[model samples]
Target: MIVPNREKQAKLRAFLAKEAHALGFAQLRVCRARDAQDREELLRHFINKGYHASMDWMEETLERRAHPSNLWADVQSIIMLGFNYGPDEDPRQLLARKDKANISVYARHRDYHDLIKGRLKQLSAKLLSRLRETHPEGAIKVFVDTAPVMEKPLAELAGLGWQGKHTNLVSREFGSWLFLGAIFTNLDLLPDEADKDRCGSCVACQEACPTGAFPQPYQIDANRCISYLTIENKGPIPHQLRSAMGNRIYGCDDCLAVCPWNKFAQQASEARLKARDDLKAPALADFLAMDDATFRQHFSGSPIKRIGRNRFLRNVLIAAGNSGLDSLSCDVMPHLDDSDPLVRGAAIWALGQISPDQDFAHLANQKQDQETDPDVKAEWHLALKGKTS
Candidate 1:
């Protein structure tokens, strides 16, 4: 039988860290594939409470997501990697600018899934090659955000960072802006000491939530989250939470931006992860006017493109309605007749917000007969009945 080699494993771990840094990872740590039952219990509790919203996939893949051993039984160690995508300025500063679309900092660049996955593969290959030289039976797997892996918990176990009250990993080195990836392998490696929670009496992340998404200090009600509402929910945004969304068209960053640990955060090291100039503060009117072709062209490599034009325009319409800029009425009016019922419904809601009651009544009457979609018809009825305020 092959014997365990502690010295060889230690050397390999150091080599892996060096390769990870060269591959653009900001931090790297390792942990055993076991010892994830507590996280699994937390996930089950969250799902049982219906906090996952419409994301049924979470329920479907619960077993595989709970622990790495269940995902790949032969896996002996999990390598957690972090890539910093921290912004140069405070993202919260744009919340007051109602005319500008507030896209989340992470979504402002090319998709991290693509950028980080490539690096993970390269690092995985390097580790696999090294392992094979010593043990021919060694095997490996790499995952970015695409998998159901509980990356946050695994990262914490690997001592990369602690999951703060906002539920995202908070790093002393990179704050709340690190992108996480994982490499699971059969090779035994030394695990790092898990990081302790540094969030003392501070509740800044909880109070900063525009929609009060956090039900408690560490619990998140995804259904009430702006990020889930704008990016995950495919239907009309809940009327109760629409006003709170303000001008945020994609994801909300209130909680992440308010973290106290961010004082140590640095701007993203990877140039590709940097925010594009046009996306920093795009006008709501310009975003609303983007048809499918234009939307794809502009956000070709962006995570925003995954939502498609209909869902994207739907979000833009909500931001326009909240903008309170009467001049944007010209931009919002055209979409009232948009082919997509979701877009048209959102446009009607936006119209009511910016237009006078008399003006909205006239427009509603004009569109009422032509609008056959039940959802769009409901929007017109709601606006005409003076129920939109």
Candidate 2:
């Protein structure tokens, strides 16, 4: 059981920071892996209140995710990394362009898990090599959101930032635009001072939520979250929430974009994380026309690709319906007959919104007789009655 001296540990920490910055990470800090008791209880409270929505995995991984030692018994330190993915402009600006799709700023480029995981592995390897010189038995493991790690809480404990009222980590330097990654190690390391909550008297994020996802300060109901509805949710968007979704075809950024701390946010230094020109406010008509092949090809390396064509088209149809562009009614009509019942249901609702009432009644009359799926039929029933919710 060899332990590195204080001077040696301090030198290693300095080396880790320098290398992390060189790799384009915005912030790096560490904390004892055991410093996670409070977060574990908070996670339990969130799950007990059903705030996790349909993401059952959160409950399934409760024990393993509660603390770092529960994940790896030998782990003694946790290193948290933050990368800035701040948008060049306010993402809320695109919401008014009803004819164009409003994609969340984070999903406009390459998938971040891939980008961050690759960098984490690189940093892990470099650190491992250095560790071998002092303690050959020392080992490290890296995670980038694919695992059950409580990254935000661990990051907060590591002095990266405090979790804002929106339940996302908020940084004084980068605001709500930081992408977090973690590295667990067997060697004990000096820990940084924890970042205290800086959200004093600010409910800007809460007020900005279009869905009113927050029931109280520092709490969220994922069932009403636009981000969860558009991304994690596998079924049709709730009828009542659809009208409020507006032109957001992918994940929503309203809460994050409105954070006051973002005034100090910097443009993403990593080119791959920056928004692509074509994805920045793409025409709703164009996305509504994408088939499986086109959607796959267009979003080849993007995070949006993971949601699949049918779901993507479903979101686009909701936007088209909300757009009030009668020109898009023709585009929405095709999706009404889509193979996926989810798409068909959303399309029915969209057409009912953009199409003439008489025309929609005529189409509903013709299609209701042929529709077999109970949910799709329900959509037709609701839409024909001129119901937006």
Candidate 3:
């Protein structure tokens, strides 16, 4: 019969913490992946209210989400790590530019998923090296937001930080601007004491959301979230929320930007997390003209690359429609013949905004000959009738 090596496991934990700090992680903590009844209620409330919007995967695999053991029976410990990616400049500064594009700070850099995953895997490999030398039976697994794991709750249990009223983890040190990731193992390492909730009575994060995504304290309905509508939802945005969306083309940073705790936040050290000057308040007209190849090239080191050209242009057109930038109408005209119905629909809306024919008859007449996609055709007809397209 084999028994775990206690001395080596202790050394492994300390070494991991040291290596993790050197890797640019602001802080790290550990916890036993226990039952997360509190998180289950929050997720259930979000799902019931239809806040998750089209992110249906959040509803699937419910059992594993509520109970970490359901994901891996042998898992006994979870390592919660936080990486600071705070921008040197304030994000709210973008809000003042209601006429310009507002790309979230996180997307200003290379895709964080790629960056975090490679780093986490390296850390996991470090542990595996120690396991091979001593506890040969040890095993490791890594996860980020992509998994069904209840990372926030486990992170709370690990003393990384307490969950704030807005549902984002907040630390006294790095505040709410940190990205979270986790690793679970079969080792029974000592768990850190959970952080005391420091939110007090502040409701700034909730009040700051432009779309009213948070229904109550500590809960978000993803359906009403600008981030979800812009990044996750595939179809045309609902009319009621479009004007309120302003120029946010990718994701909204209002809630995260308003948190007072972030005053203590430090600028990110990862050169990959730095803000790209071109993406900072990028011209809506420039983003509107991006073809697939151009989109890939422009966002090569940026997270916006994942959304593809059509989805991105659709967002830009919506902002252009609300922009009241009538001069932009000429720039939007060519997209009426775009291959994607989504683009054509958005183009029609932008045309209706700037084309002063009372109705979009001028643009509709031009599109009638070549346009396909019944959705876009009907939209063109409505635009011609002086109706909201």
Candidate 4:
């Protein structure tokens, strides 16, 4: 009877793998729901060090995020899926093109949340339907990044990949380009062997960071990370980090792109995952000129749209500042009086980056008395004093 049960479990796992691949998932694996419980300490350590930055949700959902079992009492197993979104060319290549804004490779197309979640639900329904043939109580739930679930650790547990020194999952086959999604089910599934850490002593990812975000190997300081500063941060980019930011207007891909494991990476197969032509390397001037409506229409159906026009413009202005093109100063000038102080402050900083000192001081004197926001006013003073840091 036990042999028959084991055979049945194996068959169910095989069926899951088939359905997952059919749904366009690059890889699939299963693990006990509680397999990631040990990651709680790592999460806590990350939060304790203030590494999560302004993402306070991590603290709010600490317990539930630490263990999958905490998320659902009846969950017996977790199905982890990896969908490859590798780029055809190295994303780091854009870093040298200061005139073009470097958006992260992942954000160069449609948002992964919508693409992955719909497929997760479809797979869950199929799996649950199959399980119900034997156990009527079988049930399932699907999650992308919406929940507090520790996806990277769970993916590691499911043998999908090991979390690299950059603290992002690194797949030997897909490199650092796989997007993760998960399914939780009440039915028992045979867990696969967990993937061993293959990082060894490779610190290429650590050395690639422009902002020195890594305090040490395998840990990240979100406050110093360009991705966090550009995307999650709502205010001005730090003065010291702005020069290092270059023309990266959205998210940073340096660490992920520098992985030695990328030799095995393949171009993304999904049409929606491929980079859109215009977004791949948009000119800083083009982005600096966008207003709210234009920004929305341009980024429609994209993850970049979620950042809103003000924040998006703020990033563009930072890129413009780093472009070292006096031509962009004209494009950056109109934003100096933008309705949002965030944009105005960024414009002030951008001018400091490109405008002549005499011109910057004159403009600072002209705009000084009109500014009410202390932060914007402070920017004028800082720019006038040549405090680029």
lDDT by residue (181-211, candidate 4, tens digit) is 9998877788899998999989999999999
Cα-based TM-score, every candidate: 0.97, 0.97, 0.92, 0.97
Top lDDT prediction, candidate number? 2
Model 1: CA > 4 A from native:
1-3, 387-389
lDDT of each: 0.89, 0.90, 0.81, 0.88
Model 1 CA lDDT for position 6: 81
Worst 10 residues of 3 by lDDT: 1-10
Candidate 3, residues 66-107: lDDT per residue as tens digits?
777888888878888999998888877876675678899999
What's the CA RMSD of model 2 in angstroms? 1.5
Better of 2 and 3 by TM-score: 2
Candidate 2: where are CA atoms >4 Å away? 1-3, 387-389
> In terms of lDDT, which candidate is stronger, 3 or 4?
4
How far off is residue 371 in model 3, in Å?
Answer: 5.0
Q: How close is candidate 1 to the true structure, as a TM-score?
A: 0.97
Supply the global lDDT for candidate 3. 0.81
Candidate 2 worst ten-residue window by lDDT: 1-10
CA error at residue 258 for candidate 2, angstroms: 0.7
Model 2 over residues 243-350: C-alpha lDDT tens digits? 899999888999899999998899998999999999997999899888999999999999999999988888899999899999999888888889999999999988
Mark the regions of model 4 whose C-alpha exceeds 4 Å error after superposition: 1-4, 387-389
In model 1, which residue pairs have backbone atoms overlapping below 3 Å?
none
Query: Candidate 1 residues 124-171, lDDT tens each?
Result: 888778767668887789999878898998898889999899999999
